[model samples]
Target: MIAKEFTNYIFKNNIIRFGEFRLKSGRLSPYFFNFGAFNSASKLSSLGEFYASTIIEKKIDFDVIFGPAYKGIPIALSTALSLNKKDYPDVPFSFNRKEIKQYGEGGQIIGSKIKGKRVLAVDDVLTSGKTIRNTKEIIESEGGILYAFLVALDREEKGLNTELSALEEAARECNVKIYSVANISNIIEYLNENYDKNHKFNKSVREYIEIHGSKK
Candidate 1:
C-alpha cells in the first residue's frame, strides 16, 4: 500500500521535485522532498498510515513519538493517531514549539510528556540534523531517553564534515538507531527498474547521486 500509493502521490503531486536545486546545506541537489505537498486530509491520512506501518515493521521499541517544531508537528500527531488504529495503540506523541508559549499552559513540549521514557523521534527527512540533535537534547533535558529516530526518507548525503549521511551520523552521534521508509539508493533502483532508460528524471538522479552520495 505504501509502495504504490506513496510513490504515486509523490510523483502525481510533484512533491518529489527534480532539478538543480540548492539544499539548505548549500549543496546543489537533483531532487528535493517537499513535505508541504501533502496538503489534503487524504494525503496526510495516507502518510500517517505509512509512518505507522514503518514503526510497527521496524519494531522500534520506545515510549514516546517525538516530533521537532514546525513541520514535524503533524507527522508526530498523525502517526500517533494511525498507530492507535493498529496493534501499537494509544502511543503517546509529542512535539516542541519553536517559541514557547508565555501564557496559560506554558511549555515547550506538547501532547505526551517525556519523562523517564524512551522516545522515538519522527521527522520528514534528515538533512543537516541540527534540529534533530537539538530535539534529542531537549528530550534528554526533560528526562526522556531518546534511542531511535525515524524519518519518511533518507537522502543518504554526507553530513557536515563527515563521511556518513545526516541520518547515519545523527544516529551515531546521539547513540541511537535510525529508520526510514526509503533511501536514495532504493529510489534509484526503483526508478531504474520502472522508468525507461532515456528518462531524464532518472538520469539526473543518477548523476546527482554519483556526485554527492556519501562514500559509506
Candidate 2:
C-alpha cells in the first residue's frame, strides 16, 4: 500500500526525516518520525483524519479509543474528532496519565467509562510495546476489554528475535488483533520508488533497513 496521503503529509510537513541519529533504543537510525510536531489544531485535525481513514479502511470495530498517554492523548482526541467529523460517531475515548492521580478522575484512566467496552488502543508507534501493555493493564483494571491495537507505524524489526515485531508481541499479549497505517518496509519501498538510491540519504536508509528491519 502506498499510503499516499500519509506519506505526502509526512514528507510535506517534515514530520519524518532522513538522518544519522541515535534512537531511544540506542540504535543508529536512518529515518525518524516525530509525531510530536502535530501541535497546532490544524495539524492535529489533519493527523486525526488520516488515523480515522485508516480505522475505516481497516474496519476496526470497537466502542472506545484509548490513547496510551502523553503522545497518545492528542492522537486519540484528534482521531475521535476526525471520526466525528466524518459522521462515524462513536462515544467513549480515553487516555492514561503518566502519573496516576489520586484525585479528580482518579487513578490513571481519564475521559470515559472503560468497563465492559471493547477498546482499541491507539498510538503513533509501537516500539517496545511496554507503553501499550501498561495502558492495557490500566484499562483492564477497570474491566475494559482491550481487543485490538492501532498505530501509525510499525518498525517491523525484532524485539528479541527477528521473528517478532513489537506490534506482534503486543497483539499476542493483549489477545487482540493489531494494525498500522504504515511500516518500515512501506517507507523503504516508497523511498526506493520516489528517489534514486544515489540520493543523499536514500541508499543508506535502504541498506540499514535491509540489514535490520526484516523479521530475520
Candidate 3:
C-alpha cells in the first residue's frame, strides 16, 4: 500500500491513538496502538499487505517467518498469505504454541519447517522485547536460525536503562536487526507533519526516547 493509504488505513481504523493510557509494559503512554482489533479476513489481508511493504522497504532477508504464540500466529499467517498472493509463495510461516499440546503437532511450534531456516519473527508491537527474546530462544532451541524481527511498532523507549529498550538488547544478543512499520519517532514525525502542538508531544516522545530508548 502507498504511504497515504497506509497512514489513512491505520488512522481511520483507530489503530493509533493519542491519550493517557497504561501500557502493557507499565509505562504511561500518550498513545496506544492495537492492531489486534483487525478481526476480518479482509482487514487482516490488508494489514498483512502493509506489513509486507514495510518488510520489503527495510529489505529484511529471511527464508521463513515465525510468529510467537497467540497474537503472533495470525499476524505471521496473514503476512505469509499476503506474500504468497504477491507471487512470493515460497516463503513459509510458523507459530508457537502457548503450551505444549499433548496431541497432533506435539511441540511448541506449528506450520512450516522452522529448523535451520533463517527466520524473521513477526509480532504486533515491540514493547519490552521480552516476548521476542523468548521466542528467539525457542526458535534457536528448535534449530531455527533467527535472522531478524519485524513488528508493527517500536515504542522507542528505553527498556532496561535510559539508553536502550529490550528490543535493542534482543537485536544485539541475536546479532540481527529490528525493523518496525513505524516507531515513536515516526509517530512524532507524523504528528508534527499533521497536527498543532507538535513540539509538546515530540518533546515528550523524545524524552522517553532519551530516557528509555537506548542501550548505554
The alpha-carbon root-mean-square deviation between model 3 and the true structure, to one decimal in Å, is 2.7
Segments in model 1 whose C-alpha atoms lie over 4 Å from true places: 1-5
**What is candidate 1's lDDT per residue for 70-157, written digit by digit as tens?**
7788898888888988867678888888887889999778888999999998888777877668888889988999878888878888
Better of 1 and 3 by TM-score: 1
Each prediction's TM-score versus the true structure? 0.92, 0.91, 0.86
lDDT of 1 at 169: 83
lDDT of 2 by residue, 1-216 (tens): 426668777778988888887765677888888887787989989888888898888899999999886788888998998898889976579987788798865787788878999998888876767777887788888899987888888877656554677777777777888888887777767787889979867888777766666463
Off by over 4 Å in 3: 1-5, 198-216
For all predictions, the C-alpha RMSD in Å is: 1.8, 1.8, 2.7
lDDT of 1 at 118: 93
Instruction: State the local distance difference test value for candidate 3.
Output: 0.77
Pairwise lDDT winner, candidates 1 and 2: 1
Candidate 2 residue 190 Cα shift, in angstroms, is 2.3
